[model samples]
Target chain A: MRISPTDVAQVMTLLHDDPEFRFLILSDLCGVDTGSVMQVVYHLWSDATPDWLRVIVDGLPREDPRAPSVTFLWNGAEWAEREAYDMFGIIFEGNRDLRRIYMPPDYQSFPLRKDFLLADDAARSPGQGVRHMEQTFQPAEYRRTPVLRQGLGSDAGHMAPGIQTAELASGEDPAR
Target chain B: MTTEQTVRSLDDPDLFVETPGTIYDAIPPLPPRTEREAEFYTMRDGEMLINLGPQHPSTHGVLRVVLKIDGERVVDLDPVLGYLHRGVEKICENGDWHHAISNCDPLEYIAAMFSEAMPVMVAEKLLDLGVPRRAEYIRVLAWELNRISSHALFVGWLALDLGGLTPILYGFIERDEIVEMLAALTGQRLLFNYLRIGGVNGDLNHDFLSRLGDWMGNALKRIEDQQKLLNSNEIFVARTRGLGVIDRDLARRTLLSGPVLRATGIPYDVRRAHPYSVYPELEFTIPTREEGDSYARYLLHLDEIKQSIHIIDQVLHRMPDGPVMAKVPRLMRVPPGRAYVSIESPRGQYSAYGMSDGSDQPFRLRIHDPSFFNLQAVGLLMPGNLVADTMAIMASVDPIMGGVDK
Candidate 1:
């Protein structure tokens, strides 16, 4: 139940190996300040066994906010880690692909940080602007990453190594 | 009409290229475009971007997918939330105990009644205020009606998504009745604003009970009529039957609750698991279906409607009357502690978390929204289905954009 910080990859492996933990729903991840230092947290659940388990793994912040990505194990964990990255700035290593989610592609800073602020709410450029409800816009200011014309021609994102693109879609199983 | 299609000015392709957002002004009354496509083409690497909501209408709120799509099939789907975040957590952080419900209830519009009551019940536990017996019975009555109404709309929307149009109107017709019944007492229909700090804001009258009893007796037949309309229609069955299934194993693994979980054959109803109000006193079965398919989920809603009506009938029969509110200090305070109270809402298990610094206002409040858990199941069920089935799967989840994004 308790996974050591360095063996985080093993944590995901063990979860997959154990049939009981069939689906580990990565509920919410946050960085809780434990007074002197900070700890990156993970909340994983198994409905098969009906248990909500908290798998806490963290280290010094100067190093990348790295941890095992459960995207390979549970389909539900795909976005949760991305959210942790966007807000708490956690770097989930071995996650074959990673990208800015929620904020504009060129967002300057993660908004959920303890010391994060909001940028102006105005659509400055097409694709650069984060349109909420297609109403008031937030201009992606001079952020670290450059903004791209979003939703242009992109279809889908990452897939596990062995999974075929077409196979990993709905209606592939006619019986289903 | 013509052999090809109806005439309209808005459907012109040239309008999209030459005059975006100006389609409303064109005089020729083009056929309304059934689908709007806006792809943010031309991108570079290094940045991670995805679409959350545009794929499923369920995420019309702040939820967007931070997609790194290799093709139509998602290689990576990162749900970007807080875009619709109004900081309900922060607001609850700043407000007093009684003031929090004003903000919390609206977050989950589909299950607002349950959302409003769960917070107050958790606060009551912390405050050690025993609600009067009359208030207890009334709470049960109100919640039962609300649950039935919420389920009815779910029935209609699910049918609509699967291409059965008649049930939508039938379901809406039933929903309007409950809204009217709830409205007569609380004044407003949707956001009841019924729960006060110690007890409910108002108590039910005889007229509401009489109408409720009559409706409960006849509602089953009305619901069955809805079923006959589409339960076995070939296309409806084909579109929904085995698709978007979250197997029993996957459902429990994700900690999925409510009808969605029940559809997979687990009887984890919060009312049964952790009883509050007068639910423990009532006798009713937690309707569950063994198959995890969309058909199972669809059938489960009908079973739930029957269960809710049965519960409402019992509440009316046994509801004892007295003063609704229990006595409490005008300036409320509680010993410093934490209490988590969960209830079976229309969607699923909804709970409120409290950290009391022994003050009138909770130092911290975290709500475990049911839709948040249910919607996440989309990623699990969505794959392997064509783009068309996406909406059907999403509509089956019966999410509130406000609830999911919040």
Candidate 2:
């Protein structure tokens, strides 16, 4: 069902009351900026059905962003709300605990916000210790180890260039 | 919202080893919180705080579950992740479109095809490019094989979790074959950076098809053999029969997808309801379970494997001869817009949310990993279960850690 911003409160209540949507799990809440302002998108799913609902609730001042938390419905929303806080600078009212999820707690600007820019010096080597991504800092000269693979009964590609039984290499039976 | 110290015992090590004597090396069971769990029982009369892992073998991938239990039952379960979170989304955000595909390989390493495709499919939608029929077929082929292999791992892992060892060996016996097949075609066994922006990075030759077809022919029998082994084992049935019983109401509310949602008897296959690639034209059945228990969920995978094999048989027969790529502008620029796309992975429904500011790289990209959403569900399934059956239920839910904590 297509819902409006005015109906966000009612929808949140329906998420709790409606047996199908109760538990009110908000799978993802991310900001999508059409141009000037970003539209807040909420992806919700049913605990019973193999289905999900995409709910779009706009929270755009691009400055003083705020949206009511659905944490009351599902406890899982606590962390999701924290991620939203760090990425979009969106304040989740009534959120049980709001801290930066991916970034350090003292971080300033939200990396996911459309206007956020990467620092200058890190341009030449994108893999360098550019701010925000520290623990996963890989240098420019890094080369991934190449993968070697082969199929059974066929020499279409490189097969490690060794003498092993065809079926044994494929992990299948030679009898087959 | 809780990082309770009560989950630990004074004698417990932060990281103690499970399966101490075995080669498998599983994590040891969490020590019972007799004194504190008793207080949690007295205070809430219903609120129970139980731990799921850091040691749990079901998905020993740094997964932990905090459950609010109400006397042999789970009132609410909140999943604790970030243990395996490498900030893959953050990594993807900085890299260009091409660079991102390589990074996507590790998101859900088990079903690397789906993980890799999740972003590529969205990029295609954003770039407004047509995927060559050959590439779509190749994707369908690789994806189905990956689906089967992942399902095999699930079946085997479930067996291992439920105290059965035979099925796992049989399942991996088949997995090694498929991994070899993928390795030959994509040049990488686990991470296939084979899918490029406009088209595939390579072609699907004769040997790949024949090898894949051989596995497809025998995988159905393997599933059949597993069913025989499990169906005959009374212990397997008893432990898994009604343990971790999931109600349809909770299943629908949580938006459970894949086999778990199917195990609850809902036909919400992304391939069926929202058919992508050649799923619409191809023939396959959507497996379902009415009981909504671990056994029904367990039986559902056996059925799903059959369906995947059936789809692969068609993919092999209708192997249309053509180029595996489409022509496109070298420098891609997606016009300002947004598109949310999903694929029914072996685990559940995996989706990607893409936005572009009329640029080559997306202005904002968010990957809604299925395991991330599905892992939250362990809270719902873990309650009312024995400390041992926790892993069994986890296997039934099938949370791939890479996907869960990505």
Give me the candidate number with maximum TM-score.
2
For this target, which candidate reaches the highest DockQ against the unseen true structure? 1
- Over the stretch B1-406, how does candidate 2's per-residue lDDT look in tens digits? 2222234464666325311221011211211112222212222333446675656666658776665566665655545456777656656666666677888888889888888886688888877788888788888888888888888888888889888888899889888899989988988889888888777889986777678768766777778888898877899988888877767667655556778878888777888766777788898889898998889988898888888888878887887888887877777676777767788888777888877677676666777667765665676577566666677788878877787667
Candidate 1 positional error at B173, Å: 1.0
lDDT of 2: 0.68
lDDT by residue for model 1 (B281-323), tens: 9999998988788888888888888888788778777878789
Candidate 2: interface RMSD equals 21.1
TM-score of each: 0.71, 0.75
TM-score of chain A, every prediction, order shown: 0.54, 0.58
Write down the C-alpha DockQ for each prediction.
0.12, 0.04
TM-score of 2: 0.75
Chain A of candidate 1 gets a TM-score of 0.54
